[model samples]
Target chain A: MADELLEVTDLTMRFGGLRAVDALSFVARRGEITAVIGPNGAGKTTVFNCITGFYRPTGGGVLLTHADGARFALQRLPGHRIARRARVARTFQNIRLFAGMTVLENLLVAQHNTLMAATGFGILAVLGLSRYPVAERQAIERAREWLDAIGLTERADDPAGALPYGAQRRLEIARAMCIDPVLLCLDEPAAGLNPRESDELNRLLLRIRADGCSILLIEHDMGVVMRISDHIIVLDHGRKISDGTPEQVRADPHVIAAYLGEGDEDEVPAEEVVA
Target chain B: MKSALRDAVLSALVALRPVPVAIAVAAVFVGRLLLLAWRGRSRAAARHANRAFAERLTQAGKYVAPLLLIVALAVPLSGDRYYLHLGILVMTYVMLGWGLNIVVGLAGLLDLGYVAFYAVGAYSYAIISTTYGLGFWTCLPIAGILAAIWGIMLGFPVLRLRGDYLAIVTLAFGEIIRIVITNWVSLTNGPNGISGIPRPTLFGLKFTPAGGPGSFSDFFHLPPSPTWRAVYLYYVILVLALLTNWVTLRLRRLPLGRAWEALREDEVACRSLGINVTVTKLTAFAIGALFGGFAGAFFATRQAFVSPESFTFIESAIVLSIVVLGGLGSQLGVALAALVMIGGFEVFRALADYRMLVFGAALVLIMVLRPRGLVAGRTPTVALGRKREISAELVAQGRG
Candidate 1:
């Protein structure tokens, strides 16, 4: 509990009569890669939405314990306040990079709340009287660092949509990083990537973890999940089937049964469970 | 041998024709290039070249402001009173377009009743100047403040609505303002309207022909003509329009401005970025209305009259078209569109009956030819080292 960065206590999200996430509880440890893997309708993403404040949970609470010892009940905050106040940032499954903005601007926009506050919400900035120039220079510096980290400095000026699929995936992660979040939530970061790109994503996640950031990842790629995740949580039918180290979760019979349910093939192949 | 050579040349000419084949071939080539540009280049070299071209355009954009100002200043020296008046009118629309740009273009709010703020400004100035005996300068800021208040009022209801619903409510708001002014006889003089609104004086100096003390003619010791007032009014509006441009340009680079555009691109994304969406929308409305109010006051003084008829839904449509036809986020595009829309139409005034028909056709043609508006590229507010212009077509509307 001392190392727990995020605690989800009996989180439940119900849509009318349907319970998308029912009585889900888990802890994401500080400075480690914790992943949630489940079948398509198993409500893994529903947990992300609730924790990120995108969907107000029908019941239960999400507590985020910052590295500095401050705690925030993320469930009480709005979507924006979750990011601004709780210092938790998330990327979408569908790659929500600002398509019109340049790769560099996409990163700069992530730091918008801070920059706006630095310039006194823009009045002094307009009058040429604010400390905005210094703040802006620092923002650009941070954006450049991310651009370099993602190997996207060459395409920094290009429109984000102009990047190839693999690069866009990395750019989304880089953009979320620009928020300087204590906890980063990435939803299926390697969903469509080839093996090489998937390897690159694993390295990037490892590097981010090395920088003292806790990551809560939701992914389906078994190779990625087994390669990088320190801890794994598996869900089936809106309930947590198993939670443990990757090896433990990989060997669990319940997790295998959840993936290979009723003799119907799901996205996760049964044979890959061994590897 | 001579005949054979001549026959070959003749055959080539016949294949080419005078215009049709040549034009068709040229069109095909250009169409192919545009398709490639729209789809973007697969090769890194082509993208590099495109970036270079866009960067050059951004460099050229730096000089466009000063050049425009110089051209605007030299206009009055031509000594055509009619053109000066026309220039003033064009600048008025330029101000209105820039104001509405903040709302519709930057913030992505489809405000159909922007002219209501303009009306509030004009009426505020008229009532203050005529009844309270205030000067033009004195009433200017008051007019802007009043319109901005109305803008905030409009902002509250439409905060939850977006796109077409927001447009519908704003359109209704415009009609309501006009109707209220028309019915409020004691305050607004009803359909008769308010007239003899005093002209703005140059400090204490009047543009009177009697050549008395404190009159422009006596103070400057120049021959008085009716054109003097028109010329002075031209400069006043020019200054105001330039101020609008200056403030808008500066704001576009600021954090708030960037936030507005970010919200426009994706509201959900903006909220996730920790931006207060309500404050962002309200500021866009208030700032846009502030300029609308300023232009409205200028209109009242310029015409020496005030009436509900001037602030019709058509005025809103005209301002909206100016922003759309110009290209949404391009400041230079808005100004150019105002000229083409307002000033260009003046040239066709002799054909009065067919004037509107031509204007309508022209608008449709422009929209068809350039769906992203005339100036489609947006210069990004933040860049690494060198900025590049982003094609508007590449930008997804992002509601999905």
Candidate 2:
């Protein structure tokens, strides 16, 4: 469809004898939260790694369609170019923040490409000529906006590593957002978040979607997936078991079987099927 | 107070011998450690105390900097040629420390072959001036650019390397440059070295007495003395070192500088941020080499000669030690370190035979007392609202 922002077709990733992700195909629509949830080792992150160009998929193509109808084959591009040219920003499962830098500087670093261009690759910035000062102020303004949105404006001067764990998670998302990405991929952002923080994350994701950015989330939290996701894809043994709206995926027998297992279906409570 | 008086008496009794003085210092350091341990202080508490002490030292450094600059500016007034020469040596290393600081401090690239670029600059100046009869001013920028080109050349092959691998390659690169200079007799004159290198002139006015019409002494109507040449060379290096510091400080606030620090903090994070890591790293290498090149040209002109022996691996190690001792990425710390390390050596010249032993002992004592070097606190380049200091604990020791 014209609204389809990302298409992963027949994606296959193998590590020696193990097939981490096997022929997984899915589409993330524009301006929608597409949750990819499965049990541990279901290859959700491997799929993310492939799409973000962290890994070269063994087979098939991951295509991204930009707002103006430009197409990019993500797997062929370098890891950085995927983020630079294709505007795909991702947060790592194990928060890859510039821990040594200040919270505001972390966000500023995210806007590196923009500021670099404005600075004329540092020449004009050093010379104090051109539109660099204006660009730098605007960059700081954008960083300030995100810091306010994430409620980290007060601690903006502190080193990112010194922030509380939950604050760090929020800052990572804010940093990713500063890239002005069209597609934001988050890997287990709610992993260590408290219940209250998880709710805040859900609101943040919804706000991002409301702002017309697409989100591809790999989350194990059923509450976050079901409540915030517009579409859901279920993976089992690196294969797609179910794909549809939240209600449809929740109702699928295969997804229930994948979560609860075949013979132990009665052993677990029905309410705890996906949890 | 009794024990302190006793320790002072013992140190004073052995003041005539350098070895005993070093022993006294070591003994004092150990006694303090024992006292701290006896008080039942935890390692964390000890670390905290050390950091507080370092913070005070940095504050003192703030007040001392201008005073030191005044002392440096007024050195030639004493007309003591030995002190003037010593000042030149210390400032050369200071410039070199600042240059290597760009690669090792800010970028967190441990360059063990930094002296290679220094060698390139020195040789470039020596050859250009002596062979082509080019003036020192003409050769200075050319030498800097040539060294920067060599830096880029070295940077290309090692873009994928980091940590120990990067160190090893750079170490080998330093050796390679020295060995090439040792064997390349046709171009570099080999171990015989290049001699009679022309000294720098003040806009075509020579520093020599023999330049009857166009000499500094003749034009200014002053008595001709060799000390004038030494004084002029001192100012040349002083200006060059200050320029290096200025450029570095300005770059720290710019985008490229931020990118370098970010690259140091987390290379993978930098890549995901859409930063071209290759360009970021290469610029650091090139710029760092550029300063080293400037210092090298200055070294060549001041000595009026160039030799392969001057650019040995130990020179690289000494420069690297100055950077580490000063505290990585701290410019003031680097200058202080170079002063202490180079100037300290000169101060202890009376202890001839035992110099290395005392130097090594002092280094160990400093490392034990201030593990993070002299200045460990980092002030952010950009601040919103009031700026706060970031502790060394929060900063990443960029392995690359």
Candidate whose lDDT is highest? 2
Q: Pick the DockQ winner.
A: 2
Clashing pairs in 2: none
> For model 1, how does the per-residue alpha-carbon lDDT over B170-287 read when each residue is reduced to its tens digit?
9899999999999999999998999999898999788765567788877888987778888999999989888988888898888788878788777877776777888989999999
Q: Across residues B1-400, which tens digit of lDDT does each residue of candidate 2 receive? A: 1122223223323543557567757776886678678656577787678878877887787787788789889999999999899999999999999999999899988888999999999999999999889998899999999999999999999989988778878888999999999999999999999999998999888999453678999999888888889999999999999889988988888788888999889898888878889989999999999999999999999988889999877788788878887888888889888999899988888988577556666765676677667887677878788767788888877878
- Report fnat in order of the candidates: 0.69, 0.74
Best by TM-score: 2
Residue A272 displacement in candidate 2 (angstroms): 16
Clash count in backbone of candidate 1? 0
Chain A structural similarity (TM-score) per candidate? 0.94, 0.95
